[model samples]
Target: MNVIPYNYSPEAIRLGILHIGVGNFHRAHQQFYINRLLEDSDQQHWGVCGVCLLPSDKNVVENLRSQNLEYTLTVCGRHGGDEVYQIGSLRELIWGVEQPEMVIQKIAEDTIKIITLTITEGGYNINKETNEFDFEDEKIKHDLHYKDQPITVFGFLAAGLRKRRAGNCSGITILSCDNLQHNGDTAKKAFISFIQAQDKDLAEWAEAHVTFPNSMVDRITPATTAENIAKLNELSGANDKAPVHCEDFCQWVIEDHFIGGRPALERVGVAFTADVTTYENMKLSLLNASHTLLSYPAFLKGYRKVDEAMRDDDICRYIRDFMDIDISPYVPPPAGIDLEKYKQTLLERFANRSISDQVSRLCADGISKFPVYIVPNLAKMIKDRKDLTRLAFLIAAYRHYLKYQLDEQGQAYDILEPAKSVEDEQLIESDSAADFLNLSAFKSLNLKTAETFVPVYLNFVNAIKDKGISETLKLLTA
Candidate 1:
């Protein structure tokens, strides 16, 4: 028997954007939008030059190269329905850790107008206290010492911008697709702090010339599994080397701020607006908050899959109540979005049985994720004097998961725990449930707000212990 892999010829397009942290979401949302521009218009100069931040990304790089940097995306559904989309928008691929100079050189090029990042929430090594670059972080220190090596993303950006300035290249957009509040602003602050710490004049020049666009991106993309690989081959009839499978929903809303150049993304399903805060708040507060709620409880209940837990009536009802009660009031919807309808659509999407998004996947990086996704709503609910029973339950779930204990049945599982530093990458796991809340982490929280949360959080801990996980679920849901 003979087998042939699909071949996609690279178009003669100049790289106008360099995307760092090119993960599944980047492929599904950003690259998908670029693909639309490629097919509809003649301006092919905006093709993406992909940059993988981590050394482990070599697997994806090799797979992409095998298929000439092209892959398929399937927006799968609960039933037997699915939508297939494909595009060759990644014209070039560069592994940052392997070829650090290439990343800097490409970014310094006059043709590259944008440098987008999907480096995840925790990837940016910022000091939580100062909200600035963590100079003490080994990676940051190494990057600063070996400034020529361009080891870290911030280092690469700073070095490239300095080069562009020396050469008088046009200013480029720095877009962040991470789930941080005011993500673009955070990226800008990090860049500014790092640059200023090193050189004052360059920092001022970057401040005056560059553009940082904040965006809200949504899609439920689980880690690639054997099943996912098999599904890609079965559904698409091509052995996709780096296939990205997701639920049948996707959304990208951006502030229409760009420097030098941009793709006609509006031709696709992207929304470009003046104020993306409302959209950002809605997605983070409701969608992400609810996800944080379900993640731990589902894992504690021994349901590994997101779609499976969504099928549980107990879980589904709690999810709905979480959105309508705890999360909805805090989230001001973007223009033209019906909050209720949107919630309904999200519930449907979450319940899509075919997509096996994992609970552990959602639970990762809670130290960073909760601060943005859950903390704001928690703070707002306290301000409004709303009942925190639902929010408290989420905290309780975190506490229970931190125990990292199997149920009475002796099944084993894992939950993410924070470390003392980035170098101490191991999770600080323990059987003590209270250790999970880490009240010290919330000490900087407003005095009045923090005091109120203490009692409710304590009450939740009692409920989780006095009653079992299922009973706590019933109490919260009822």
Candidate 2:
């Protein structure tokens, strides 16, 4: 297949956007949009300068740099087709760990007007219970003490914004594409808190100039496996590294609150609105929460791929009921959105055979995900006195998955929860469901003292323990 590459010359494009955590999602979603915008118009200056903060990102950074920061993006469709595009929007790649000063300088540069982020939900270092930046985090502490040589994202932001202020560069918008609720506001709070602690003057400057616009970004971008790479190479006949693939469906709803001018993203499928809360809530609750609800149970049952799990009748019904019965009630319909269609579309997206989203990817960072995606809906269901059987079973599955490292097939896998603490370990290991319910993580919701919910949840936990996942799920649904 002769793939048409980016039409614009690399020399003419200017780095207008600086993105942190340049992983698979950023490439497939945000960069995909920018690539379209560039192809359609003369807005060549809106090119992205990608930044990788962690040391582990060296491989990707090197790969992109060696390839002149150009890579292929294969968008897979549900039925079986795919559209391949050469993404040239990524004009530059910077490894922050290798050259922290360069990262700061790029941020301070006047041409850079917007900074976007897809740092995972836990990267903010917020204490879920308190909903505040955790200054006590060891990385935060190090960043606080050694501001010149920073490590965490917060440190980089604080230092970078300080440089921007000193240089008298125009204000920039920090748009967060993470899946958290009110992600833009969360980013503001986390960044402002860090800056305020480091330098009151810089924080005040940021308050006056910096803008964090909340955005709801949706796209199912699976981790690029070795098999995917080999297949992509064979199809394209190109020895490209760091290529990315995602589902063809993509949506980006952003608040139009940029300090400086923004790319005419609206020209190319981006929705710029005054308020994104409703959209954010709907997506997070229905799609994200449903993912969490299905992940642990599917993984524990030895299902590795989301589509495979969706094919299972029992698992499919459980997720459908969980979304319609448990989550849909809490999510208000965003403007111009049909809730019924959206729910059905979510199911279709989950069942997209071409994407092959991994259960392990969904199960990763359960500690952070549970608080953001599951807790709020769980609390609402308890308060409303609705059916808690499915919700309870999901929690039970999470606990079981956490406690036991082995899946149903007796295969050992490491649970990738970095936020698990000593207390969390105790709660996961505890035999009593009531003990897990009383955890400080869920203390804010006070589900522990619920008159009916507690007992129902406990019973579900016991049933799962006594009668295995399959039978318990059948009994719950029946």
Which of the numbered candidates is closest to the native, going by highest TM-score?
A: 2
- The whole-model C-alpha lDDT of candidate 2 against the native structure comes to 0.87
Best by lDDT: 2
Q: Estimate each model's TM-score.
A: 0.92, 0.97
Model 2 Cα shift for residue 455 (angstroms): 1.5
Q: Which ten residues in a row have the lowest lDDT in candidate 2?
A: 437-446
In the range 3-29, model 2's lDDT, one tens digit per residue, is: 657777778888899999999999999
Give model 1's TM-score versus the native structure: 0.92
**All models, RMSD in angstroms:** 3.2, 1.3
